[model samples]
Target chain A: MSSSSAAPGRGDGAEKPPMRDALVAAAFRLFLERGYEQTTVDDVVALAGVGRRSFFRCFPSEDDAVFPDHERCLADMTAFLAAGADDEPVRRVCAAARPVLRMHAENPAFSVRRYRLTESVPGLRAYESSVVRRYERAPAGYLRARFAGPRDGALRADVIAAAVVAAHHNALRSWLRSDGKGDAEAAVDHALGQVRAAFGAGPVAAAGKGPEDVVVVVSRRGAPLWRVVQELETALGRG
Target chain B: MSSSSAAPGRGDGAEKPPMRDALVAAAFRLFLERGYEQTTVDDVVALAGVGRRSFFRCFPSEDDAVFPDHERCLADMTAFLAAGADDEPVRRVCAAARPVLRMHAENPAFSVRRYRLTESVPGLRAYESSVVRRYERAPAGYLRARFAGPRDGALRADVIAAAVVAAHHNALRSWLRSDGKGDAEAAVDHALGQVRAAFGAGPVAAAGKGPEDVVVVVSRRGAPLWRVVQELETALGRG
Candidate 1:
């Protein structure tokens, strides 16, 4: 999101940046001064001192102006996931989610303001959900490719992907609600740690199962080996 | 959903059901014959042999007509989750999600048709996401209450809720994509079992962590409990 002020690489250096940033600045100013629904593309362009064609060239819709860098973040995340062929699937996917948080954290005050702005508008809220749904697809697609053979491969991918996104989002939301102060990375790391603990695979697959077959336990971190064994037994109702 | 044909208990069955059902039926017929954007509230009422007042009384907007039962389904799920005080958090939330699937399963042909309709219209797709977001809050809220003591309590609730919803939707989407032909319950059951395995807590607390704290491991099902512990030790790099 840091480079959102710079155009989407349609052009580079000194030509497109000012107009793009001006339009974004103008849109938020007007949106804050006179509510989101009350503002229009024409009003934004008028404030930005640009023509209507320029506005359309930069943003497909008014909502796009509200969330400028999602496309870049999504592409970066997709590329990152694509490059990780040998890593653990759950861990790789959780790491893949980091760039998204970085996008929001790159400009904390703007992200915080946008969070409040999105909360206030129904259209923007739905638009935000659709954007998030798009983010979830990249890691899910990656995991699906990795777990392609199991009958439940798609199901596992979907659930783990959702867990990673939810955990990251839960952490991000808390940080934003606190006015985007403190260490966003730490909050997200702690939250993503929960996902890893809950969904991560072992160094070796379960001993007697098929290579793709598995059983999982939701256990505590840092516990001694024997107690974790007891917890697994209790979870399976075998103790 | 079967009873979406009935009023929202706004009134009894003597007169409201036929008119309410007629509005929905007429709206869908017109939406299919003419495109959703091409059709209007006036056309729906006119086709139903009713006035605009009758239409608005039954549904607040055209989108609501497309997904008429979500409100009822959401209410049913919230009540179901609210009553599960003594159950394990993840398992209870998974059960709470069943009502939503049952709503779709209750009327499979209509669900398949509606899924197609939703796919074709971006506006309706966003609207549907908002509705699904509403359903997620019920279990998340319930789990949040059940897990209020720990610092990561809210985070656990959010991630577990997302996992449950994603698994259920994955199952439901496959069933709907199959033209709603098979046993939806069995499909949903299989998918949600993945959630139970991935996120479900042990029967007892971990030996060293707080009773409210937890750690979880995702592994294979039906494996020996000792194998699950081994997987955990391996995941934690203690092996």
Candidate 2:
């Protein structure tokens, strides 16, 4: 994962392709040395040996370069989810979340620095959050497609997506907090396991079985009496 | 739920003083009338009869005022979670989420207008993202505290919190998309119910039981397994 070289000029600097990676490396170096607030676009440009126009052409804003290639990763993840053959699309969606971990693993140092910066800076924090919203929506949409029925499967899909993201986020956040030195991929898997455990431990396969088995038991007891009956029926049906 | 009165703000008028609700009303009205981008802090100040400095004083930025008293609400929720006697804090945390829905319900029009503005304006959208981050963190922290045992309960708590917020956001976004008309509280309740069903439906009282009877399992099904197992073992143990 660490061996993959940073791609230059995917978004900006079409004429001078190398300027994009150069700017990223330059920006991270400068950010570390001068601190994020003190470092300007001019500093990054000067260090990267690129003109101001070239820098802006590569990255619309200074903050944009700090994070890894989220746009590309998101597209890849979307394609992966779309390409699933399994009828259990939620599992496929969960499987697709692995790429996000792989992405962070590709550049652990950059990921760590980006984590530190987002935590300290509000604008970057907002940018990071917007990216997370996008990440969450992909799986949510996929789950919705998978779980679609007459019921509020939209809500179910959204929660499943949320739990998946939540798991990923917890993994990522804890790993970042550990300065990316920890096993982020394992953390993500652990997080997703929680998602699976939360939504899994019962008759969800019946999701495709139709909305007839899907009862909304509102009482927050250990489990509603009806859910117990439903599970017994599901187990008996399986037997 | 809709009848809950707005609380008095801190005397500084910056930290949500007495006239906070009035300012929110004035700001939303101006946003609707003149358009959100065209409307200025000055316009909000003029309509609310507060000084320009006071508007800035109340909200560090104009975008901040679009939200209800989140700081106060977060604090209220934190207190609620801390004080809960439920051994399983996840249930208590889910219960605590209702205050957020109640806050929106109390001022449906204001929430609706804010939602419209945020959807249209990039700046407000950024601000909204930051607010959602806060929403995710509170339960994440509470869940972390309760489930920080040797097992991966910490990750479970974090994911549960994330799912809870995702459900809340999904419901809130749907209501906002619908222009805040009709059963937003119901939508939110449905969303929260999904969270409770996923995470909180487990056997909460199993903490006191012996490990052999606890029977921790993870399945790909969507039913509440922990409770089902608890009930099964309880039945089988007696048999």
Top-TM-score candidate index: 1
Best by DockQ: 1
Say which docking band candidate 2 falls in: acceptable
TM-score of chain B of each: 0.79, 0.71
Q: What share of the true interface contacts does each candidate keep?
A: 0.55, 0.43
- Name model 1 segments beyond 4 Å from true: A1-16, A201-239, B1-16, B201-239
**What is candidate 1's CAPRI-style docking category based on DockQ?**
acceptable
Predictions in order: lDDT: 0.77, 0.68
Which pairs in model 2 have colliding backbones? A12-A57, A12-A58, A200-B221, A202-B223, A203-B223, A204-B222, B9-B16, B9-B17
lDDT of 1 at B116: 98
For all predicted structures, in order, the TM-scores are 0.81, 0.76
